[model samples]
Target: MSVWLPTAPCTPRTCAGHTGPVRGRLPATALLLAGCSLVLAGVVCVPVVMLLGRAPRDRLIRWWAYGVVRAFGVRVRVTGRPQSPEGAAHTGTLVVANHVSWLDIPLVAAVLPGRMLAKSEIRRWPVVGPLAALGGTLFVERDRLRALPTTVRDIAGALRGGSRVVVFPEGSTWCGRGPGGRFRPAVFQAAIDTEAEVRPVRIAYRTARTDGQAAGAAAFVGDDPLAASLWRVVTAAGLTAEIGVLPPIPAGTLPGRRALARAAQTAVASDSANRSAESVHH
Candidate 1:
């Protein structure tokens, strides 16, 4: 298996069952419609957003992303500061996070709008494909080992051009109920090449009924259909997506990409552990 093609053990039967409070069919349907409408609206506005300057375009993208998540009745709570992308002296900011669900994409963009590092398959997705391309996503051919160097170079070029890039280094989506996949070090090479600032962000899903325990409803793990994941999110009541932005790791300060990847994984894992401990204490 290719290094970029890591797999997660989580599946719908094993991990995505929703134990949280659920909304009525009518309301859930309404939320589903609202979420789809927002996504369609974003796709339509892509051309217009492209015409704007960087700052305004980023602001618009952030707003659109937040709206999409909110339309699904999923609340977002962000902790810790995201490093600003406006550092003129440095390369772009590399935002790395743990993958939990399809919602993770917009959830991260809602706070830190940037070019996304995604699987090449997403570019072929129905409505999302065109939007991702227009929004400047960096797609990787994960199944092809030979494509790794080129992908890394593309990421490095984007960073050198000062584009903030969001990546899920786990390479696969986890259940968010336990330790996530390892942070693959390949993408970190881009940060190393461009001397970019690596922002380690941790994503978690929870519900009010669970007393802040991790929510499995949002996990889009192995072999999970997109429609199934979408339904789970819309039907889930009081689902909260939390973004924990840990301190930034200066790529220049790190000895190499492997060390940088480890440092980032440690920061994100430590934060997750701390949050879990707090939930237990309460």
Candidate 2:
């Protein structure tokens, strides 16, 4: 089992349901504002990408994510920054982060310059998909195994093209949940085949309630309304998020994809557990 500790205000806290209307309304209103921005970004920013070209598209989408963070009333704190491969300014790099929330996308974007490879379903999400596409995001359909080789090739090409690509090894958000969640290992294929240095990131939401307590207390996974949960989170007071980038997990003697994924997962899970334990002691 792995434990998690978040060191920011965004960590989840479920105040008694009776905890005043003001607290509840804040997260809701903030989410509404952010959602509206996504709608606008999808409609306006995505089309602008075609006119402005890929570079501008990437920049604008990042700006859009920054706006979403602001609207959500969440501030981000980063520790243990990732190192881009030597000469990577002109090459592709792979960024791997442990999944935590829907906010993970914007959080990663805000911290590092990279386009993300997300599940194909995300692209179909109302308002979100278009904006993500504008950001040069690649969507993968996990169920379509036949298409995986192509996907891996695409990722390799992106890295070779000098674009930094982000991947979530957990394959889904573990928002407010403790660590040690099984890692899928599928995404590791791209890094291995491409010989890309995998940058690993650990994310934890720190809230006034408790360190990483938001994972279980906050609503994520299992048919919970994403928008609603987001709203609840933003309005809740004193929420902050922090992301820590571990050293790049280079292609080591670790023989295969499973080994690589495990290495990365272990690094992440250990960090999460340590943080959680430290929180308890504090």
Report each candidate's C-alpha RMSD, comma-separated, in the order given.
Answer: 3.4, 6.8
Best by TM-score: 1
- What is the per-residue lDDT of model 2 for residues 1-282, given as tens digits with 9 covering 90 to 100? 111111222223332121322355645675667666774655665555657765766677667676666567666666664556465434466887777677777777766758788778888998778777876788777767776677778888887777788887665555545553566666677777767777777777666556445434233444456665666566655656667777777754478888988888887766543342211101
TM-score per prediction, in order, is: 0.92, 0.76
What C-alpha lDDT do the candidate models reach, one value each?
0.86, 0.64
User: In model 1, where do residues sit more than 4 Å from their true spots?
Assistant: 85-88, 125-131, 272-282
Where does candidate 2 have its weakest 10-residue lDDT segment? 1-10
Misplaced by over 4 Å in model 2 are 1-31, 49-63, 85-90, 122-131, 211-219, 272-282
